[model samples]
Target: MKAGREELMEIIDLWGYSEDAQARIREILESEDVPPPHLFRYYGDRPGKVEQAERLFERTIGTPHALAVNSGTSALMAAIAAAGIGPGDEVLVPGYTFFASASVVVASRAIPVIVEVDETLNMDPEDMARRITPQTRAAVIVHMKGNPADMDPLMRVAADHDLTVIEDVAQACGGSYHGKRLGTIGDFGCFSFDFYKIAQSGEGGFVATADDYLYMRAQSWHDTAACWRPDRYAEERREGELFCGENYRMSEMQGAVALAQIRKLDGYIGALRANKKRIRDQIEERDGLALRRQPDPEGDASTSLVMFADSRELAEEMMAAMRERGVGVGGRFDQTVRDWHVYSYWEHILEQKTVTDEGCPFTCPYYEGQLPDYGPEMCPNTLDLLSRSMHMGISDTWSPEECDRIAEAINSAVSEVLG
Candidate 1:
């Protein structure tokens, strides 16, 4: 029998903030600090929460510099701006990732060239290699669904083409590939601390990088070109032309919650990983299901557990059975009209029109009024994979026993669906 909708909703609500995070937020809010110590003000005199969170993120990600931004979309936009991507530039993006992966490229006034994804649901390196043109300036390698993209080949292709690779680690914080962290491998890595991510602070994002110039550029770009001098708390005005940027700075309150969340990230990842393994062990060898493959066999996965069924009917049957058992199951791509994460749902990008009345990026003389098509015609493999794939979301609060039960539910569901 299937679990009631109300019961299933309760099980899914376990993904956000732990006791520690709540306690920390309470502590920060209760303190009687003057001036609020916001990111808009220099923290040297007050030691703001934003700076504290930035440092913590740097340490956790093993990067030299980490900038806290208002959202993952801002991080991606800043990264592209810092990379000097502008009108007529082309950026390669995975066809199956969150819409922001391509939307950010458009935000940079550049055209996004959609690339196909492999079985791992990551950007296909071979297709990436084939898509390179003289106009290609960069690629955004999204770690979609917490799975790392195959970096070695992606890196090689980037190097061969003299293109910058930005790591979109929005769904993959704390995830790694071949002993290296996902965000640290590329020229720059972006992370999201939004409500549903591996770590959450209500809504916040972080950008990590080892390159000093890129870090400084990202910092300036995120804050509307306000020059940051660590020694001086005030943002120095730029004497020359303005560096392209926006008001994407993270607030002290957001930082407070994110810092606490980062502290618990490792533990949360460990628990989720253990639970994923338990579930995988139970379902991996099932006849009708295929365990999600990873770019690196030994790489660490984030909270989501993915699998593919032999057909769409089999997948739907398994999902129905799991739901009946009070275990939530879902497809890889969101089916809701309000959700616009997948490529097929991005009708805006398919149109390739800018908010500008001039249609500058698309109509820029360098582009000669040309734009790449971003419709289903662009990535057949990604469409096929999404049709047959299903995903199981793991929560940090689930105990070992709950994990076992989830695994049993999956096995049982498979048996009932395929039989």
Candidate 2:
């Protein structure tokens, strides 16, 4: 018997494995001599599956260095450490992004200054500029939902402030910005290959950079102060001598899966982009409904289809209408729905303290006087725009019939709301 719609919806891991990916995993499992070489990434190391995956990642992202780590959050943490962001340092992050964008700053012993987002759901460069204080050291530009942020102006702002920019391309694996790949455009580009991301590795991520010093710094963080190149090794070899580091290394098994996934990434991104464009072209200009304004020099990886309505009321109406037709429409303001990606939905970030007891990051005796409190009022624009936004998932696996049904549902929902 065929499965019910509700029953099918319960199965969340839609990340189907490619035949190539399956074969690679099988080989790893079946081989007797498949022992990982230099799993710790020591110098003069023989290249294994992990190193091979790193090389492929570097070539794919057009970066000089790529260090695979345990998770996207680990990639961000390593990037933070590489940039030398520490106590009293402030990193600007969009208030509309995933929790890791802000939490990673905390983990780095730095403060995350929440900044407002524009209609594009990306960090507003103007607001980011306004939030800058003497303590501001870096900015993390998230390419939310595989849509590239406007890097031109954002880069200019960061340059003016002498702030290091890190591109959070977790959702934008195969995406680019103005012909340049998303992650390579910044000081450090971080990517996630978690099961849900564009490139699935079960659980994995990497940091990409063009600077040798930063690459070495990241390597230290990835393997507990172990040097990537032998020359950087400390003569005394004291703990935390080169720098305070942690264990965030990716395993050879994970690397094998990621290497296979990388080969199929471009085709998947291309298909999803085409499907998104087809749907957007059909419904974007309809009255009371429109696609969110994509940044100039847009790179559509088509991770999800986001639509904004004239107001919150219209957005809610359209959401209900779409759901009745079997389309799972997600709204930014729906707090009860726990999985919404909007920052307002992440109460943990606002409620929890960055550092326990001492308030080492926020209240640490580093910056000028007292730090400004982070709360809802800090990003009014983000709060407002998100109230009227809704989105639906897009995937390479979607069939033409599925696309048609979605388009029809969107059209009908708009008509129902307008009528």
Candidate 3:
């Protein structure tokens, strides 16, 4: 007998792995010939491996420098610190993003000014322009869920205001914007390799930049109290002094896994894109369910596929139904930083200091006063779309058949729940 819809759904996990992955992982684990060391030891003396890793990164990104760090958050923090953005400085970040985007700014001792997002769920350049003032030192454009932010206009605006642009390319490892890789476009680009990411190393990240000074600073920050000497990092070390930051370096084991994953990035990206297209084609006809639109077709490269709901109620209902049928879905950035209670405590600190609207430094009420009245109208498109959006993971492991099954199940569930 044929299985029921629920049965089929239960059998189809979104992230299906190839047999080769298991073999590769096992081969690495069983090897005993001077077994690969963890990152701590690997980075201690195996300078040649680090050089190989850097070469791989350089070839893949075509960037002048790539500083592998512990996490995407560290990359952002180090990059912000290296760029000279500090206390009293305001960095514009999109409201609809992972908390890290804003957290990094706060961690850097700078204030995070929340900006609205456009249809693509990226930072809205118009809102960004309105929020920018004399104190706005930089902007972190988070390519939310692997979709590239509108970089062309964003870059133009940054140039006009003399502001630095940092591309939070953590979610967009293989993504590009206007023929340029996502991380390479901005003043500095950050990438993550957490297990859930497209190009994962179990836990790691990297920062890419063309600026010699910023690159050198990032290296020092990754290695506590360590300065890059020509004899030490020769062809690898780009620039910077001995101002040691925190230790956020990635290990060689993680780097090895990352190197393996990087080799398969293009193929993985192709499979994800193809699967996304199939799923979207099947579900776009359903009512009360909408696919997230990409501004640039070529720029959306990661595997975390997002969709829009007609309303918050509908979105919650759809998510419940999908989960009931064994399909996983997630919400977009619902807890905005401005609404988080932690910011309130920080408010007191800003209150003790002088805040001037002349430049409109930060988003805190103490700085901006009562916060800009952000409602549905201020960002009609994002507000409307977010109320009902949902996301699904598109892993390299899923087959075309599995993707089709997922799409059909989602469509049927939406029809049954909403209709």
Candidate 1 Cα errors over 4 Å, as ranges: 1-44, 225-227, 230-242, 334-338, 368-370
True-structure RMSD, every candidate: 7.8, 7.0, 9.7
Candidate 2 off by > 4 Å? 1-46, 225-228, 231-241, 296-298, 337-340, 345-349, 352-355
- What is the C-alpha lDDT profile of model 3 across 64-96, one tens digit per residue? 998888789888988998898876677887876
- Model 3 vs truth, CA RMSD: 9.7
- What lDDT score goes with residue 219 in model 2? 85
lDDT per model, in order? Answer: 0.80, 0.80, 0.73
TM-score of each: 0.86, 0.86, 0.76
lDDT of 1 by residue, 1-419 (tens): 43343332343344465667655655664564344223442444777788898998888878999999989988899888888888889999998888888888887788888898988888899999998888999999998887889899999999999999999999989888888888999999999888878888888899899987788788888877464565434544443224656888887767878989989988888877777777777774567788777776445555688888888778888888889998888886545543566677777777765787887677777764346765756787887788788887888778888988988888888888777
Q: Which ten residues in a row have the lowest lDDT in candidate 3?
A: 340-349
lDDT of 1 at 318: 84
- Candidate 3 local accuracy as lDDT? 0.73
**What is the Å distance of residue 185 in model 3 from its true position?**
1.1
lDDT of 2: 0.80
